[model samples]
Target: MRTKVAIIGAGPSGLLLGQLLARAGIDNIVLERRTPDYVLSRIRAGVLEQGMVDLLDEAGVGARLHREGLVHEGFALSFGGAGHRIDLKRLSGGKVVTVYGQTEVTKDLMEARAAAGLTTIYEAESVTLIDWETSSPRVRWVKDGLAQELTCDFIAGCDGFHGVSRATVPSTAIRNFERVYPFGWLGILSETPPVDHELIYVNHPDGFALCSMRNPMLSRYYVQCRFDDKVDDWSDERFWDALKSRLHGEAAERLVTGPSIEKSIAPLRSFVAEPMRFGNLFLAGDAAHIVPPTGAKGLNLAASDVRYLSSALIEHYDTGSAAALDRYSEQALARVWKAERFSWWMTSILHRFPETGGFGQRIQQAELDYLVGSEAAMTALAENYVGLPY
Candidate 1:
């Protein structure tokens, strides 16, 4: 089979790119190594930058999002046993974020793709990219015990960090930078009303905790844990007790506890692979970079990458100019580095470090105090939180 673009991985990044390219009269095929159900079942970050929301609108998949997504003009930051609010909208010149699950976004994209009859190969096994350096690149995979190949003008590597897309790049051709945090986030999804109408981020002596919600009744909460911690080590009662200990005042008093519907632990890390483009192949999303979830930049960063890539590809097809395509890696990396910095900074200020000792804790407290007390500092945080310009 031959196409204009061959996309590896049917995650949100791949699906969003495929939708945008298809709507722009570009032919693309998406290949996924997992089944549709497995893809949708994966829980991920829900916060959406205005830029991402607008992209969804452009792709014709924002109706449900606009209807169901919760809008937050501000979020609470707790330190010194008190909650402080950052006016994201006011500080960011009337910008706000939408709280919508990443799962829902994927579902919407999948529905749109199916309705438009776009080609997506699900449950494809052993997918590999061949001849990426050549003008005519191809993706090979097994479907139903039969070998198949797809040739395309360009290839999009939207697969996650562990996928084959990045693995295809030679070590010498790319430079990798990574920092793995010593702790992880132990999160729980419960069917109880959130303690606060807006999300609350807590920095306490115990650790960092976040109070986020999927809807009015579906709440998602997290508390920092050691790298060696296990989900089975904590029960619903223990988790709730620990989370409450980090919160203060009304936040702790108003919290509602319930049986967890889903629980998992996610490690924190910041990583980036430079030069997202490798000859005719380009990497997007987790294939090229990763950020700690502290600033909620993961999905937003992926959306920004998609925005740059789709525009570049569309420009190439429309004007027959490879300028944008040639500069794709440089352009994407500029924004990637900024998001990485913000995620790293947020993680540092909010989480407890094992070796930071008392001095480090005091420094973190002073930073938070300055951030909440100073308008400039607050504005900076709000700008990054709502998302930097795409």
Candidate 2:
């Protein structure tokens, strides 16, 4: 088989890239190692920046999102057991965010691709690329216990952080930066109504807790945990008690508890690899960088990469010019580093430290106090939360 562009992974980045390339009349093929059902239900990031929403709408993959999405004007910050709201619309000159899960976005794009007759193959395993130096890049793979190969004008590796594409790049040519936090987040999806009007990120002496939502009946919440803590260790009662402590004095009726449908322990970390492009292979999304999730910038960064990469690929095919392609790495990294820094800063301030011996606790309190007292600080946080432009 052959295509103009061979995309690896059927996640939001790859699928969105395929949609954009199709709009540009660039034929492409997408291969994902997982089943379609798994990809459609990968429960991940839910906050969408103004720019991300625009991209989805322009790409014609946001109909369901527009109809079912929750639009938030701002979020809340709670510290010293008090809540303060940051009016994002006022702070960002009318810019806002949308609450839609990554899984739903992927589902939207997948459905759109199917309707448009785009080529997306699922459960295609052991995928690899060969012959990059030739006029076309070749993707070789095995699917259903059979061997297969494909040729394409360029290869896009959006297979995420643990995929084979990153390993394909020579280790000598890659530069990595990483920071592992002492804490992790124990996230849960509960069948309960949200406790707050908007998302609430609370900082307390115990740790950090976030009150978010998936819909009117589904509440999403997370609490800081030690790195080695297991999800099984957090019973429903224990989880509710921790939330109660963090949200002390808040109405118990508002803190509705319900059965947890999903739970996971995510380590807080920041990782970035420079030069996102390697020969004919380009890495996007989690394959290139990872944010701490405090700023909710992971999916947004992936979408940003898709924007730049798709434009470059379209230019290359239409004008036969490699200028944009040549600048891909240098361009993607600029935005990647900005998100990395912001995520790190947010994670540091919001999470409690095990080594802090009381002094560190005071520092966190001071920062939160400053954020509430100073309009300039609140504005800065509000802008980052609403998102900076792509």
Candidate 3:
């Protein structure tokens, strides 16, 4: 098979990029190692920045999102046993965030691709990229016990952190920066109304907790946990109790408890592989960098990466110039580092680190106090929360 771009992975990044390129009259193919159902079944973050929402609109998948996604003008930061609202709209020049699950976003993209008759090969086995350093690059994979190969002008490595894309790059050529936290997020999805209309971030002496939702009826909640904690260690009742204990007054009183439909522990980490582009191969989303989820920057960062990449590719094809492509790495990395910093800063202030001791706890309280009390601090938080400009 021959194409202009051979994309690895069928996740949001890969699918979104394919859609953008196809609409631009570029030919591309997406390869996924798992079944479509499997891909959609994976639950993920629900918060969407305005930038990501705009990208969805550009991809022609924003109709449902705009209809169903919850819009929050502000979110509450709870500390000292009280909830304090940070007016995002007022602080960040009237910017806001949308609460839309990643699963729904992927579904919309997948449906759009199918409706447009775009090609996406699922259950592709042993997917590998070959000769990405040269002018002509090829992708090889196994399907239905048969081997196949594709030739393309460029390769997009949207296959995620454990996928073959990043691993394909020689370690000698890329510098890796990583900080693995000692804690993890123990989260659960329940079929119940959320405690608050807007998301609530709690910083309790015990730990950090976040009350988020997919919709009015489906709530997603998380609390900080030890790295070794397992799903079995947290029953539905126990999880509800822990979550409520961290909340204060009205938030705790308004909470609706229900059986958890999904439970898991996700480790917190900040990782970035410098130089997102390697020759003809480019990495977007999780393949290039990962941020702690405290600031809800993980998926937003991915969307920003895709924005830069798609713009660069579009310019390259339109003008027959590689100027944009040549600067893809530097351009993407600049925003990536800022998000990394924001996520790291939020995690540091909100989370209960085991080694932080008493001094660190006091510092966290002070930061939260200043953030909610000072307009400048609140504006900074709102700006980062609504997302930096693409």
**For each candidate, what is the lDDT?**
0.96, 0.88, 0.94
lDDT of 2 at 311: 90
Alpha-carbon runs more than 4 Å astray in model 1: none
* TM-score between model 2 and native: 0.97
Cα lDDT of model 1 by residue, 227-307, tens digit: 989999989999999999999988999999999999999999999998899999999999999999998999999999999
> What RMSD does model 3 have?
0.6
- Residue 365 deviation, candidate 1, in Å? 0.6
- Per-candidate clashes, comma-separated: 0, 0, 0
Query: In candidate 2, what are the lDDT values of residues 1-390, reduced to their tens digit?
Result: 989999999999999999999988999999999999998877898999988898898789888998989999998887876788889998888888999888889989999999999999888988877866466889888888999999887889999998877778878989988888998999999889999768988888889999999888888999998899999999988888888788746733479988889989998789998889888888999999999889799999999999999999989988999999989988999989988888988887888888886888888888888888888988888888888777
Candidate 3 lDDT by residue in tens digits, 120-224 = 999999988999999999999999999999999999999889999999999999999999999999999999999999999989988999999999999999999
RMSD, one per candidate, in order: 0.5, 1.2, 0.6
Clashing pairs in 1: none
Q: Which stretches of candidate 3 lie over 4 Å from their true place?
A: none
Judged by lDDT against the true structure, how good is candidate 1? 0.96
Q: What TM-score does candidate 1 get on C-alpha atoms?
A: 0.99
